[model samples]
Structure formats: C-alpha cells, structure tokens
Target chain A: MAINWFKYSSPASFYSLAGKMIPLFAAAAVILLIMGLYIGFFIAPTDFQQGEAYRIIFIHVPAAWMSMFLYVVMACWAGFGLAFNTRLSSMMATAIAPTGAMFTFLALWTGSLWGKPMWGTWWVWDARLTSELILLFLYIGFMSLQAAIDDPRRADKAGAIIALVGVVNIPIIYFSVQWWNTLHQGASVSVNQAPAMASTMLMGMLIMVFASWMYSIAVILKRVRIIILERESHTTWVAELQKDGVA
Target chain B: MKPRHKKLAMIVAGVAALGVASVLVLDAFQSNLVFFFTPTQVAAKEVPIGKSFRIGGLVTEGSVQREDTSTTVYFSVTDTSHTIPVVYTGILPDLFKEGKGVVAQGKMSDRGIFKADEVLAKHDENYMPPEAAEALERAAKAQKASLSE
Candidate 1:
C-alpha cells in the first residue's frame, strides 16, 4: 500500500497539521539553540588569530547558510506552485519570503560585525559580498513584486519567474572565492578539502547551523498556517474552525 | 501529457534556457567581477599603468617594516610565484601580520611601488585554539631542525 503524500497539499488539512507540528519544531529549535549557544560561547576555544572575536561565526555562518538555503527552497516551492497551479504551494512560497529576508538581513548584519575588526572595514564590494547582497535584494524583489500585484495568482507567477531567474546567483555566491581573487576568505567547510577549522570550533558551528534550520522550519510552519487561514477564510472548513474557536 | 505536465515541462525548459544564458553572461563579465588582482596578474603588466586597483595575497614573511616616528609602513605581498611591494600610511588591522593573507588597494607608483590608500587583512579559513596553533608551530620548527641536521 502506498501512502498519498499529496493529501497534505490541501490548505485546510495542512493548516491543522502545521498547527500540530509547530510546537514540536519550536521546542526542538529552542533546545538546539540553547545547546548551540553553550557550545559556541563556552565549549569553543578562542581563535588563535582573531581571538574571542571570532566566536561570532556561530551565528554568522549559520545565518548566511540559511539565507541561501531558504531562497532555494522558496524558489522551488514557487516554481512548483506556478507549474502545478496549486494554491497551497503558492501560499507556502509566500509564507517563506519574510523569513528568508529576515535570515538574509541577519547574515549581512552579523557578517559586518565579524568583518569590522578582522578585515579593518565594515563593508567591501568583493564578489562574495556583492553576490550575497544581491541575494538580499532578490528576496526583497520577490516579496515586493508579489505585494505590488493585487491578484494572488498573478503575484505567484511573477514571483516564480524572478525566483527561478535568481537561482544562478546562488552558485555565484557559493563559488565566488574560487572564481575570483576575493577579499572574502574561502569556505572553511567545503567538500573538496578537509575543514580548515579545529574540531571543537567546527562542532559548535555545525550545532548552530542545525539550530538555525530548526528555527526556520518552525517559524515557516507557523507563518504558513496563518496564511492558510487567511486564504481559506471563505471556505466552509475554515468557517467551521472559526465557529468552533479552533482557528 | 496532461496540462499540468505540459506546464511543468515548459517551466523546466524556461529555467534551463535562463541558466545557460546566465552562464554566458557571467563568463563575459568575469573580469569586472574579480574583486582584486593577484601579484602574478599585476607583475605580468596585464594591469593598466597609473590606474588604481586592489592586489591580494600573503604578506611575505619578514617583509613588514614601520618607521619609528612615522605612520608609514612597508610590506611585500607574495603569491609564492611573484611579490609586490606595498606602502601604506594608516594604522594596520590587528590581523595584518607577516605571513598572513592581505589585500591592499592602491596604484603602482612611477618608482614601481604599490601606494595603498587602504589596507585590509585577508585571513584564511583556519580557526584553531592558541594551544593547537603553538603545537603546529613547534612541530614545524622541529621538522626544520631535523632537515638542517
């Protein structure tokens, strides 16, 4: 017997399912956050070069990673929505934008904080930095373009086009150091080489990365549930949920 | 194929075409996208004379110099294959040490020197505790001594 995975593609069912799953993800996020913070601040040793100032990587690296990862995820959802004309897929894509933008902003902010002391400047127009900045702009562009359109279907289609087009920048950002003589350092944790970092520092960074992932999933799920309720407000199921005070 | 399948195929084709277009575009704009030039690039006279640019590489070991009473500092950046002399007047960043990565933005002077307006430390991705770093240094020293003996 095969399970029908498409059943949850319905907004009414997904909304309730999301509501049920939110607390679990939220709890995992909180737990991982605490553990990650403890490892980052307490267990990790001072950097031999940057000293304690380098501890900011715990937040900076994870936020940067999440920003790029979330954009790909958002674009994929938007593309699927556009291709299949699925209402739930479009709503999910819409719900992911704000969170993706938030992570992008966080990545930029935390990066500057790390850069000011280590690089002797708060900002530079290096290839990696510029590409990442363009990513932030792309996220904003997607959201604003969608909001500018009054019709939800048209907004989804337009956003999907922009999202798919912007996917090229993702590879550019990831490979900027290798492709050019960039001011930004190459990745510490790339697949082709052994990590350039110590084991403990690497562990802390990885833990924080997992924490960010959990946090993003929880927040996106909660946001999608609200979006579902708003989009399906006229449906009988939503009306019953509102009447029963379960919404 | 169904209408949905047709739509999916269309989107995939559009995305693939867009990807190929972007690759070509990026290739054409590759030179402009480079943040800095290496010492090898600059040494080959490929860089335009009298034009300001950035050169990034490792700060040559034992090449740093500073005046006792002046703010001016001199250093050499090397990519192992080539080296470029750099001069700056501002205070250096804390991480700007000899044998470390650096990027200096400036123009080549008439006397073949890089007059930097801004100097920034370009650190590697390595992050280790001081103890681990000291251990590595000690091991390197030991290997050097054995080789000499």
Candidate 2:
C-alpha cells in the first residue's frame, strides 16, 4: 500500500522533499542576487550628495529586513511544533536558527560599516542597534539551549518558548525610530506612504530584499534536509533510501 | 514533578524575566536616544542649539585644525551646501579623515561650534576593522572612478 504523502510529516517523507527543493531554491537565490547586485551597483544612479556610500543600502537594509523576517518565521515554526506536537515543524525551526543568526550578524556588521560613514561611529548603544544586538543574543541563546540539551523533544519545547518571548522585540526593533527619539532614521519606505528615496533606489532595494528572501529559503531548505537525515537515521525509510542509492 | 523538568522551567522563566526587564529599562531611557543629523539639516535649523544631539557629514576640505595639546581637533563638517564646526578632544578613530563621513555626538554651543563628547568615523562595507589605510585607498579609487564616469 502506498503511504499518504502528508503522513511524511513523520520526518522520513519531509526529508526527501526538502532534498529535492534545495537545489532549485539555491539556483534561484544565486540568479536573483547577481541580478540585484548588477542593478544596484552598475545601473542605479548615484546619490547627488552621499555618492557611492549610499550603495551600502542595497545589502545593509535587505539583510536587516531579512534578519527580522527570518526570526518571525522561526518563531512561527516553533509555535506550530509546540502546539501540534509536530516533529517536522520543530526540525524546520532548528534548521533555520543558524542562518537566521548569520543574517542578524551580517546586518549588524554591515550596518556598522554603513554607520561609520554616515553616523561617524563604528558602534552605538542607540535603540535600533541595541535591539538588533539583543536579537543576535537571542538567536545565540536558542542555538546553545538546543545543543546543550540531550533530548531533542525537550530542546524544541524550550527553544519554542524562548522564540515566542523574543517576538516582543521584533515590533520594538521595527518601531524604535517612530516610538522613541531614536538615533536611527525613520522608515524610508512605509507600506501606506510613498518612499522617501528616488524611484531607482527604491527599486534596487526591493529587488535586493527579494533576492535575500530567496537566499534564506534556499539555505534553510538545505539545512532542513540535513536535519531530517540526522534525526531519522534510525527510521526504516532512511534505510530503504540508503539501499535504493537515493540517500 | 521531575527535578530535571523543574530546573528547565526555572531557567526558562529566568531568561524570559530578564528579557522583559531589559526592554522596560530601554524603553524608560528612550527619551535620551539622540541621532546624528547632517550639516544640511543643522543649517535648516532642524537641530536646536544647546541641545545634546549628533551631527554627521563629511569633513570640509582644509577645515581641520589641531590644538597645541595635539589631543583636541577642530573641524567643520559640511555637505557642500552647509557647514557645522565641531570641537573634539581624544584619540579619534583610525578611519577618521578629512573629506570623509563623520558623526559627532554633543551639543551645539551658543557660538555655533558643535562641542562633541564623542566622534565616530564611518567605514565602507568591504573594510575590516583596524585597517584604515586599505579602506582609504579603496575609497579614493571608488571616488575617482565615480567622478571619471
């Protein structure tokens, strides 16, 4: 009898599917990023005053946006796992943790580089910067907590609770400039209002954001496949796949 | 109750409480979050004098002056259209240079000079820390290429 596809949520089925999706997403990520970079650097018009220093926005803003976005995504998966007792969901959250942390680190590091030229400082304890730093720590804490624990199920539950609590910071990070007299600038592109920047610059930034989103999906999918393999090593499906030369 | 489960619960609660406390503390101090404004913004009277804040722009050419003590440096930050003079005393970041982006945190004096408590030098994306010379070279090349094109 053929097994139901949805039952593959049992880890064995999701593993094969994740493996199939990784290469496709990776190819899309590479293509979109290269195209986005070309438009950002070569084709975009230079700022009248800031000149090339403004180019840093293409990478900085997108990475910053993605860092926050990926955290929320991780939290959602964790929440689902906690609520439904779904093993696949928690594994997906675990898979996304490292990449999310990397993006957060990248955002902070690149923001510092951009900030030095624009703000004249390598670092500050300002609202936006401070909150972002906290996000990084949260990511680290989640990963460490998961690794330090011997039992995977207990680790997932603990990590899920932490992730849920960390969600409070996400809104604070996004609204820091508006809610407080922050050192950081207000939003340049709001959902309801027109963008403060030139059209070309906005286009470039948006394209880069899409590219980053694609890249995250690609990396997370790849990581999820490895996680499934390790977690399901004792399963009969894994044994069958290995015997079939498909592992 | 299992001892192990109790310990895990306590740890999780402790972390969550810490996170909540920090957010509250940060929120309480939110009023002090001052951001740097460009010389153009200052010129437009967007920044109030005698109010502690930050000002950021490029160091105007030939505007840097060193006090006899060698620790104090005075310079004007400009965005071509506007200029704000700044006074700072301390070892500046290695990346700080003339005609480069700078942000100084302090109050604008009655005399219109920005008296800075701190100064920060901005670096490029490709730059690694503690290597100002290489970043300078790259900046120069980028500027030259942009101007030529």
Candidate 3:
C-alpha cells in the first residue's frame, strides 16, 4: 500500500536508489566476466577448421549483441523522457550513449581481428558491419546534438527525436546477416536451433552476455547520478547531498 | 492529467510504433545480404554468376604479376578440398603474397574467373606492421636458397 512509483520518479529519490544498486551490479559483472573468459578460452574446444582463431567469438559476439541491446535501451529511455518529460529518463539516456558506442567499437575491432584469420580479411563492408558502423554514428550524432544545444529541455527533445528515427537502423543491423549478401556469417546460436558450439562455449557466451548486462547497468547508474547532480544542483536535496560531500 | 505527462504518453506511443515498423521491414529484406562464398561452395555449382559476392582464400604460389601501377593477382580460396580461382586488378596489400589469406569482393565473370573489385589482405591477430617487411624478406631469402639448392 506504500508503493508509489511516481514518488521515485523524482531525480533525488532515483539517484539514491541507483547509488545503492551500482555496487551490486558491478560485483556481479566482474564475477560473470571472469567465469565467462575462463570457460571460453581454456575449456572450449578449438574450432576444427579455424583452429585457435575462432575463440574471438566469445568476446566479439557478446560485445556486438550488447552494442545493439544498449542502443535499444537508450532509445527506450529517450522515448520515456520525450513522452513523460521525466528528467531522470533523459539523464539515463545521456548516460548510456557513451558506453553503447564503446561496445559497438569493441565489437567491430574484435570482429576485424577474428575475420583476418578466418575469412582472410581485416575489413568488409558487409551488411552487419556497415549497419553497426551506422549505429555508432547515430550514437555520436545524438550525443553531439545534445551537447550543441544550450537549453537542457530542448536538447532532450531533440535527442529523443533523433533516437526514435535511428531506432529503425537497429533492426536492420540485427537482421543484416539474413537480409543481404554479407561476408559476415549467420548466427551460430539462435532460439530456434541448438547452438552450433560446444556447451562450454555456449555457457561462456551466455555468462559474458550477463556480465555485459550487469556492467551496463552499473555504469548507467553511476552516470545517472552525475547527471542528477548537475541538473538538480539548485535543489535542497542536492544542496544537502553536496554538503555531505556525496554529490 | 498534467500537460507534461500527456506529452510523454504521445512520445512513448510513437517510439513503440516505430519499433514495430522496423522489425517488419527488416524481416522482409533479410535475404539479399549474402555476398561471400568459399571456393568449395562455388565449385559445387552453388554460386550464381552476375550476382555480387565475395571470395576468401590464400594467394596461390607464383600467381602474382605486378605491372607498374596495376597488379594482376590470382588466388585460390579453399574450404579444405575445394578451391576457387580469384583474379584481381589493383594494388595488393603490402602483406599480400603466396600462402597469405586474402578476401576479394566482386562478382564471378562469365569466363569462370573470379573478378574482384576490392582486395583485402588478412593479417593474423598478433600481427605487427614491421613484421610484414620482415616476412617478405624472409620469403625472398628462402626462395633464393631453394633456387641455389
């Protein structure tokens, strides 16, 4: 009966809640990442054809998935901010953009490394790669657009519209493997088929995915706190938090 | 019932609609993106000519012919047993040579020659830029030694 979702919609309340959640997610992320790496590198069988080079998949695929997933989540937050005019939602969207871009770059870098040994090319303008590059550009564009605007509210509205428009590219990136003649391979693991990889490899990838998810949450929470402090600097709670040296 | 909240509702609805539309469009266009085939796959009569695609494999020994600005390179991509011949005209990557893996993007010609528009030299993950020159030097020395023998 005491539950009030709207009460926590205020930046101060959400900041405190996010602060508490960060440590837990960070710890989980570290543990899952270690386990994932151990299984992927040491326990998984070497690919019969690609030999040792195929091990890059454990990192590459998860990073790629996270890149796409984080974009969608950011767009969702941007949408929430635009529709509800929630200060916290826009802050969340802003916080997530850099991390999403980082993962997208990591995925492309690792994929190039993987491709060189297996496909005999360091780069290909295949559907998946091209669309992913576009996704990176979209992230950069959104961030730059927000930074270029002086008014915070206007920035948020502009960013939300861009994010919404760019949302169309996410699905295109995801299904590029299936839609076009790309050098990139098809999905090795899908819900419809048994994974083409060993159980250990599959487990490693899943664990890494979970780790990435937790890591994103922790990073976003930390970033959201900073945004709250900057935006609500004049508020009494912020003043008190600053006095306590917490903000 | 506040004006802000009402505006928020409209934006959320717009995003959802866009998300749905993208999923449908992507699903509809999911088949035309494939552009690469292994030599073995092509050998099995699996590749359709006049369609753009890619071929990946090692540069065949003694198949590189460089003429001033333009170079003619021939390579064979093999998935173990099957090998496809790829012919390319362009500047080969500095690291490109015999037994080195390379991928060329283009379409197969009617003459059964794999005509490439772009050539990419594949290097190992542990590659150092300086190592390419060293590799080329070592290869030349080994070839010279073999001829003298």
- Cα lDDT, model 1, residue A45: 94
RMSD of each: 4.3, 10.5, 10.8
Interface RMSD of each: 1.6, 10.1, 10.2
* Model 3, residue A73: C-alpha shift (Å): 0.8
lDDT for A203 in candidate 2 is: 79
Q: Write the per-residue lDDT of candidate 2 for residues B26-144, one digit (tens) a residue.
A: 78765434556878788788787667887877888899899986699999999899999999998786557788767688988888889999887643322212234455678999999
Model 3 segments beyond 4 Å from truth?
Answer: A1-3, B1-112, B115-149
User: What is the DockQ score of candidate 2, to 2 decimals?
Assistant: 0.12
Chain A only: TM-score per candidate? 0.97, 0.94, 0.96
- The superposed Cα distance between candidate 2 and the true structure at residue B67, in angstroms, equals 11
Q: State the TM-score for model 2.
A: 0.70
Q: Is the docking of candidate 2 incorrect, acceptable, medium or high quality?
A: incorrect
Report clash pairs, candidate 1: none
Backbone clashes for every candidate come to 0, 5, 17
Q: For each candidate in the order shown, give its overall lDDT on alpha carbons.
A: 0.90, 0.82, 0.80
- TM-score-superior candidate, 2 or 3: 3
Question: Which segments of model 2 are wrong by more than 4 Å?
Answer: A1-8, B1-103, B107-114, B119-149
